[model samples]
Target chain A: MTLLQRLAGSARREPRGTLRVVDPNPLNWLYITYNTVEEPVRVTRRGKVRPAAMSSYRWRGSRTMEIRVRPGGRFADGTSLDACSVHRSFTEQTRWHSPHPPGTHFNIDPRTRAEVVDERTVRLHLPEPDGLVLGKLRATHVMSERFWRDLGFGYARDETGEGHW
Target chain B: MIDAPGPWASGPFTLVEGRSIISTEPVVTDGEDRTWLQTEDRSPTVRLRANPHYWDRVRGPRVREVEFRNDVDRRRALDLVCDTVGEVDIVTEVPHREAERVRRSRHARLVAVDSVRALAGAIDRGVDGLPLDDVRARRALNLAVDRSALVRDLFGGHARPLAGLTPPTPLTALHRAPGRLRPYPYDPSRAARLWQAAGGGSRPLRLAAMTDWEAVAHAVAAQWHTVLGLAVEVRILRSDEEQREARRRQAAKEPRDWDVLLLEQGSQSADVPPLELHRAFVGRSGEFRAGPVDPKFERLFDHLRSRRSQLWQVLAANRLDRYVTDQALALFLVAPRVLYAVNERVDFQPYATTFELADTSVRRGHWSLR
Candidate 1:
């Protein structure tokens, strides 16, 4: 199949083959296989974001959130996407500067602290109550530990070491 | 692949041959210079093969291989898809002028969706020698221009006139009650009266717009000139560098060269959280704001952000929308739709937000090459 796109000069930077989950953020291109949770259980025709990855989430208090991860999820590298890995991913995003693009954040509030509660649960402690955290998390793409070790904070470049991975 | 460790894509498809061009340049931010490496895919075509290890391999990527052509001209691309001979399965961004042709074509169908995008003129209330600082003057300007005419003439009736900063999307429709939020009707006499009372028209209003918006800007300038008898000058920002420079100046609070800047504002998704749009266009540090920050607006926005319940948040957002509209903070124009030309042989369903082809498949009997 052949697809034709008339992209702007700036938009032509990224590969066009990737399936961007129809979301508000144009860069939210986290492939379904790379997600720590399941593909969204349901995305409304109107484009509403529903639970997919984390089975359910609740605000423990004003500043704390408890999220239950869907069990048995794995990264492309074949590593289990358990609660500890989710915590680690959140912590890493807060500690390191994103190499993807300027002005684009990891969507994790830097002031939040991630703690693993159990095998399938993680708790986030935010400095202040943020209602938009869940929406932000939807935009945050989780990468495998191997991805971090190999690519560091920088994007994965092509064979010629040019384009983003 | 030559030597890279991995592309390790977990998506429905994996990159088969990825080629691109890169350029590193220095950009200044906050008085400090930093190196920015930019990459451009100079390759005319990129091929992707279905990933066998994909999570839902059974239901995902029915087509084994997908090829994307990046260098096709917009008009020619539409024509190719509409051709009797199937040149391409799907061609996106069907030009508005050629939409009727695509509609009349038997080989292709036009898919149009109300996108989460809106074009508006950002009024610089703080600019010197401009009377836009007065709310009455701003309201006068908004009332002067005919949004319906712009939608019909410029957009070929593919857009809806905006009543507020946000477009009429499904999410926004929930918040805005009919008749509660009405677009400012074109009233040149009332506009002239308000302009005269506010002591406007002392100097020509300078309008700055990018090349893509040059035509709309000129049309608007002409309207303002004829309606309010206000002298207006339209300046086109021809290059990206020029736009960046203009934005830098706006961010630094330096003397602005233009009184009104025409720009598009919207989320990439069909369902956008109203708070996101507010922060990007109405917040004090908003990227597209040409007007001075209003403390009152910020307070309301902060209140909206603090709400936990979705209903309360939406109510607060509606209040903010009403406040902006009443104050005439920006000249809200039209909500444009995303158009696509898909071949008849392909069963393609267009998403309102992004250009997605993951579920796209050819018709039952059209898979084989003729």
Candidate 2:
């Protein structure tokens, strides 16, 4: 198995993480609050207009990814878009980044384990952490790394080459 | 989807130039003396004199004959070199052991530089070198390493093991590791204390790893579990799936659901900025590299990304050291070199350092046809 498989999952094993299914055609102004499991996802905002606070924005904290069923929708920043949404989003910095130098150690308060109890069954435990951070989850979404490496491509950085290795 | 020709396939050496069958008579130029056959090996072995009609004044190959035996086979290559039948030169990819052996026993010349990724430690090529921020923690971890053991066991001492990556080209300021980046060894006790201080004992770390890195991840996990008594589970992400996750993170076009990724970045080139690393974890990368977040670093990162103000960009990149040191989201292990073994008659330099070997030419006067 390769590093990618370890990050996602080996082919032999089942994948862990939440899964979700959204309507293919979400209505304009669709406010999605799904569980991404992890906190703060990267986003490209609606209507090509750039975000004023572009880099400082956090997907989880605010409206990250917004699309328009109707182009030229009204934006939070009072910008106009085509009848469809534009692509611009906010990015959030992690809590563990240190401002020192390269090769310095930045550590995370890792949440290592979770289990499924029932149909929609899920219980998460992050020992000694503060606050309940809600996130989006999509079971139907996660891809198996092993499946692909075995299938080819996306193996690891070292595994990359011209044609399929 | 890619019918477009690549650099090597389209020019100088065309892909269509390859022979379909070994026995097929090769296409010949008007003034060339050698009539040749394309031997299934893709490379052609020909005995050619100077083309009288050639426009260039340059003399051709030194040797009268040139032989290509498909891909060079190692043992057979060595024997050919040893016997001096059709070979007098050979290059070994394994630097320390094989190069040393060839030099001593086989009497082959040896030149060692970084040739391939080392067996000394695991390399995580992710954008976020965050988790490795704390000099003490990083050093402590390095101290716990058994470099000699890894070198001996995994590579049979063919690699010169070190705590960090050796830049392929001449030293630029970027290649140097600050005094704080020193390595740690296998000290369970120190790891325990560091873990306790870093809140490792306080929570469970969802240890993300790729299948290739599973053994190393488990080893670290075992150390964490045993020494620090920290609860951790090692999760393996497949390769392609991880790439899909990375592409999603990069494009900001898709969603991610992992805690951390054990992966390598595409490049360290300034042109290849560390933005991807920033986005991989803490940024809105589907929370793949989620957080126990740091606001100061985040603020600087924000400034760095937005402050197209030239003076500020340098400050931001410099600040990168800070951001990476504090949180330790992604850890960079080590960078290795590419290893290749060639037949004695094959003359080649460690092709230029860019990692692209397509158009690399062999050193003159060294290569000969068998």
Candidate 3:
């Protein structure tokens, strides 16, 4: 092989692990990964929310949301992910941890309540119906409940400082 | 609670951060055993390998790794591609001035496509004591801008003048009425008439613009000055972050800081999610950035976002564009062409949304070393 070809060959390994991405624009500090495709959501390319983690979702009169978590979905740490986790994720993200400044961006109403309906189902009780409810749910990054509880209010930490979920 | 620490990731590649990441050796992911290496030179050369576990074997890990070198100094990157690099697969965001030179280079092939990027100046009607609050004053400013000259002179034929916020792609072009295809042409006499009618000459106008496009902003200001004797003040923002901060301040209960703010906005799609556009213009749910909502604009935005059918959404978008333009809520600038250089050998697939790298993937096994 030619030198360039050999250099390429040497870099290759089984289950090849290299995809370098870059952007000249500096990331927003508030939402560091906002607008970046780093976070994958349960949404199809057609802008419809799908059941990657949730088996199904439906709106009740445009105000209440019922989402069914898919069974057998596990977190990176091998814990089973369920409806309570999803509820916690949405409640925390939209209320306390949103990057938007108060009154500036569209925020989920504070009156909204995410309650665990069952082991695999969660129900969101909204004060009023919102058309962009699906879109709002898609933007939420569901975190592992165990890890979230352990870490408290800060980010998940790794020994090497190189890991984030 | 909502964010993550840097050292952990779920994607195929683990980031090794530095002034630039240099991946001279391969590393495997946690548990997946997917081997990949991402390295960068200090000047910013990014080399990436595809995961053998997930990548389409028939299409690519095409050869091995894809190397990208980014430099704000385009000339240096151009030199690397033209003179020193051996079959470097791709180069992106090339300025139009360098297109001809790069086209002549034997080492790479240049491809130019229409970009989704559009430019517009959002007039802050909420700012107190500003003539921009009057539609006639806003119209005078919009009429004064010679968009054709700005595109030709500032962008060096790299852009097309925009009539609306959405780039005139197949998806978004229909949202604008046929007559609205071109923004109001340079009409000094008409602009003067509007300025006079709006009582425009008494006070100076303050304009907030992005630093990169400050020259264009200045030129527009100069046109208004000459045509209508309007004294315009310009404040330049260094980046989008600054503009967002300004918008946030504007959205507050306090009075807005400036009369006109020039900003760039890009959409994920043309209009699939009309709610985003709705929230942006009318300050629906308190997301108002245009500074002071016009009652008509607010009504149209609500009507547009409320529609469940895509057909109605498209129709509403058309009406919205015409109304916004006529009201002079925003002055549409040029939509730049996305350009890139690629090695003739690589079977590269370029997506229109260059900002999202995951969307642009090469076909597997389509590349061979000569």
How accurate locally is residue A81 in candidate 3, as Cα lDDT from 0 to 100? 61
Alpha carbon deviation, residue B346, candidate 2 (Å): 3.4
Q: Give per-residue CA lDDT, model 2, range B1-370, as digits (tens).
A: 0011111101011111111112212221112211122112122321112111111112111222222232445455554544443243433333333444555544344444443232222212131422333444444444444545555544444444333332222221332234333333557777657744543423355566655556556666565566666565677776655644543342332233333345533222221133434433344321233333446656655666544333445455455544553434334343333344443334334421212111122333343311
lDDT by residue (B1-370, candidate 1, tens digit) is: 1112233424455555533233323233223212132433234655556654445432355565566555565556666677754456676656567778888987778878787777887788876676788989999999998999988988788888888877887767866663388788999999999999898766899998977778889999999999999999899999767876776665445667898888775554433345445555556645556666789898987787677667776677778888888998888888887677776666666555545455666664553333
Winner of 1 and 3 under DockQ: 1
C-alpha lDDT of all candidate models, in order? 0.62, 0.31, 0.54
Candidate with the larger lDDT of 1 and 2: 1
Query: Which predicted model would earn the best DockQ?
Result: 1
By TM-score, rank the candidates, best first.
1, 3, 2
Q: Which regions of candidate 2 are displaced past 4 Å? A: A1-165, B6-188, B197-208, B230-260, B266-318, B351-353, B363-370
Question: Model 1, residue B360: displacement in angstroms?
Answer: 2.6
lDDT for position B256 in model 3: 57
> What CAPRI class is candidate 1?
incorrect
